[model samples]
Target: MSKHLPLRDAVLSWLEYAGSLSPKSHSIVMLMLQPHWEDVVMAVAAVAPRDEHPDLYAKVKGDWMLDHRTLLVESGLAEAAQLIAQGVSVPVSDVADSFVTFCTGQARVPERWLLLNATFPQRTRIALGRHTLQTFTADELRQTVPAPALNGLHPWSLDLDLIAGAPFLHVPDPSRTVTRRPTWFDITGPRAEAQHWQALLPLMLWDNELLRVDSVFTVQHGRRFDLHPPAVPTTIRVYPGSQGREEEVEVRDTGEFHVRPIHLSALTAFCTAITKKIDAITAGLTHTRRVPKLRARRLERAGRHVVAAYQRTYDDYGIWEVEADELYLDYVIALEALLISPDDGKDEGIASRIRSRAAALFLTPTERERTEALVRRAYDARSRYVHGDKIKEQSEHEKLEELRALRLLTLQIILRWLVLTPADTGDLAPLLDAAAQGTGREQHIDRPLHAFFATTSPRSRPADIVLT
Candidate 1:
């Protein structure tokens, strides 16, 4: 029987003999093995100690030696050993140079390996083309890759909560078929919630018919997942009886479905405009004495509604003509609440009061009569809609144009009040009261109401409004 020399014995024999030759030879050998010394120690330690398996220890040791030898061969160190053996008087520098070249030639850690190890839910074995990369836990990945390289490799950590024990692959392997919905890493923080809302806003404003074929439209009011925060308590629902009549769908529910990429541009502008307007109102209120908290609260509530109305209006490009009118009427209602104080004796007087207050605060001297007439016409249309009168007297296109004009007028009025109101006297009620009492001076209106009326003909009026 041939006696097989174990790899550990061969390497140690060469090292001991070489070390005896000179200190330079010892240092060279140590330097060459320094990168993988811990691995070598681990391989040696894995074998059964002489005491535990005294009877079969030599055989166990031989097996471990063969395993370590295979590892060295795979690491490209076997060629370096072969070269060293061929040199009768190999210089230490030559041995070191050969080992360095071998190390450089060895396979590098792939990027996919880093990504999979860092993010894969569990220890999953993935086949990438012909090579199979073994699964690595997150901790193993951190240890395998250098700290700087790891940091550069994975800036965002995997959301374990999202993974939830799901199996994963480093890369899609052609041989294996796995069915699952691709998961997105859950983003946390206040900004993350805001971003999530912003992203969903476009989808929220998208027409249901557009997505009805592609996806199931579910209206969720509360927080459905930990990732989604409590969203605004608004929903886009079709009217119960409006079957196939997308037009019959309430404007408030569907008018805002006209959002496109261009409309997103208005979001920033609207935000800036509202911010500046609120700042102006705040500054004005700061100087006024005896600001009523009840009235201020009402004004703040009205301001929020106004901003919301603007967003709805800006998003109203694709709504049906009648729905557009309904949405514009809704906006007018909110604007009326902001500008006209509640009158106790006559609920019927609200429309008149809205026209009077809007004209005084927003219309120019020349536009006063025309603006009042437009307000009355709009208010009547809103009243009929609220009273369940389906407006069908006029052409639908004409009615839509009329409502668009009303929307423009309402926007102008609210924006003007936002700009003109003094911060000290935050409520529009006081200003309207002062104007009614004939004590306040008429202010110069910068943007004329007529500019908003340009799109609609003077002959056009809300068909639902019965002119008294």
Candidate 2:
């Protein structure tokens, strides 16, 4: 067996071997060595003070400079020796664990090694017309765009050096000759995971409208012995036009790939309509005095629930958790806030108020019948969910569809309230009495439920029975 060498000697030999490799290999080796260089240098400097170890420290320091492609200078070693001689303590580690980390390429730095090899197409653009009026400075733009965060930790941070100048969004691209369109935004993250994009969706749509997200194309380095990594492209595109649409295409090494298309346009349309209604609701809440202070406060709380439900619907959380049960509860609470009076104490009274409100608000008889049924079912579901009853035997897709219809109806109710109370607190009693007298058409009512509410009933249900 060969004789064992000291930590300084071992590191020096490794550096010499690393420097002997090709330029590309040498660059990777340098990246591998960069994070631990300071600690290794300090270890070498700690040994430099001893009379027996001065030559060994100088040799190790010289090898480090060679690995870094710096001139093998004696000045750095000399200064380190002087500092150590002057009683500046050089902190030394065991070097064993650090050496292991270096060899395994698991350094303490949150450096995204994969991103270093990524090829960004030239000229990415971000349109912020819906959110901001004036052009943004580079710093302001960075804050406006969503950054990738991993478990509350951002691996690659945004810096001025990473971005180019004003009037355009510029990023580092290896292909100097290519000029691409400016509609794309290049974002960096660890391995281009799906959750990061999923988390970004709700935030993109929360308060803004018409967010046209272009395809996110990632050209990864192929695992082959070539001078440069071949561009193996993967694309995830989100189209937030009418409804939301997500298209994904992934290419594997063996030329195998998969394509999945998710259509959420109807949902997007519903959410957009609800957002407009909420804006109206907010304005009405601020200006109208026909509503009592206490009732207005309750309506405000209900508005918060509606907004939360809307945001949560788009979030990455699964359809089961986000849709039917929880969103329905928000609808129920909001409707109750608007329709239920302070003195109404019993469930029967609350149900009567809901039915009466539905009759007044719904433009057509079919809408009234369907909405009344939805309210009754939703109230049952909400009670079951709240009281720990397992919602048994319903498929997730079916439940989501049911909840979607209820959510649309709930939004219509809220919109109707806003329309009626456009200037002052509008009375619901007249509308209710008209519906009761079978003369609802005579009332000069504003119609906001045309999108989802049907004029004629497809299937006959129980007629609207007013509870005494």
Candidate 3:
């Protein structure tokens, strides 16, 4: 046995160490591991903790060691490692101050679910994914839920009486100018598990033609994001009479938010199919991130990144609130994730790859010149900002426009990618590359992109581009 271990190994060894007992009995919970464990895992893998690789990407917005330090102290691995440095091997996990019982055998994998309250003009009942969406009055809940369950409502429930019309108080606060959004819709029935439920609602939203799921279910409508955006309630209000009015209006709308169920079902299927791949891609971020599961054909590297980037837009690409520079980084990372490959970062042409690929892939031949310039400029600004160089100052409005361009470009690419990425391979990078070099497979790529566009109404296009 080695007298010493690397910091990363020391932590893992401690985490796994069992005292005088069979280690096989105790299983490690993969989910319990810190979220940013990727940097350490990658760094320690195949090489020692002190390695040749600079691991610049590990710095991750300049705080790579933030969690590591806490993990060491909390786990008491720091002391154990010091003892190891003095030549005494420590089974750090055995002597740890804390204990987490790791259970083995079959147990249900609990998913991190997001729930939010939203208002709709019409009280509609539509099946969202595998769940139904509609509001419930107190009486409705009482009748819907078994009497025993309704009687056994959680202690936190505002009202025990579900027979009343309103169980929760909608108390108005006059002290504040902005009151919370009134909850008009409640999604009942067995909630289907979805990682990116945010993406599903916009597919039905007549207004959210863009991929901004946040707008559909804004933070104003209570948000719960363990991993991704909340489930959004969409309004497909058709007539002026249907829209709610201050004066008492006839409740003509009964329960039934009907849509071509195929659209939302398809979106869920698409998101669910890619969930694991997206999880593996995002869980680490760098080359060391977990790879997709076994496949007959090798998955294209760039294609995997493309899907990861698309997922990021809907997931935690900071659709809610992020600083200007941070938002810039988010958008650039997305663009790079879609465009730049692990192999491509070795050279000086990183910006060139981003600029040319983005323009070539998404724009017309005439559009490429300006598009490429725009990407280059945007990428350069990101580079300067990250490297601690302050560039020319712009007004807040000007900065917003720049961010919007990056956002739009990222969203448009994501939508195009949805159709192309039915599988793990068939990267469009090659088609874009060949097209740039005048070997046109224009239709091969454009056909799917256009198909997605055609299936989606012109109204679904982002508000910026849509005429009316």
RMSD of each: 22.1, 18.2, 20.6
Total clashing pairs in model 2: 4
Candidate 1 Cα misplacement greater than 4 A, ranges? 1-317, 342-347, 425-427, 433-439, 443-468
- Identify the leading candidate in terms of TM-score: 3
Kindly report which residue pairs in candidate 3 clash with one another. 125-256, 125-257, 209-460
Tell me the deviation in Å of residue 184 in model 2. Answer: 25
- Model 3 residue 226 CA deviation (Å) reads 14
Count steric clashes of candidate 3: 3
How many angstroms is residue 284 displaced in model 3 relative to the true structure, after the best TM-score fit?
A: 15
Q: Which candidate model has the greater lDDT, 1 or 2? A: 2
Error of 3 at 255 (Å): 22
TM-score of each: 0.36, 0.40, 0.43
Please, what are the lDDT tens digits per residue for candidate 3 over residues 365-405? 66567668767767777878889897458766676566556
What does candidate 2's lDDT look like per residue over 1-468, in tens digits? 012134345444444343344434334335345333555454444433335332223245445222221111111221222223344432212222233222222112111111111111223222221211112344543322222110012222233222222222122224322212221233332222121222222222222221211122221111001111122223344445544655443321211111111222333343344344444444554553544444556656665565545544532223446455777677788788777654456755667677666666755677677777788888888888889896645777677777666655665565555445433455454555465557653444533233222331111112332212
Model 1 weakest 10-residue run by lDDT:
215-224
lDDT of 2 at 75: 15
Pairs in steric clash, model 1: 281-423, 284-422, 284-423, 284-424, 285-423, 285-424, 288-424
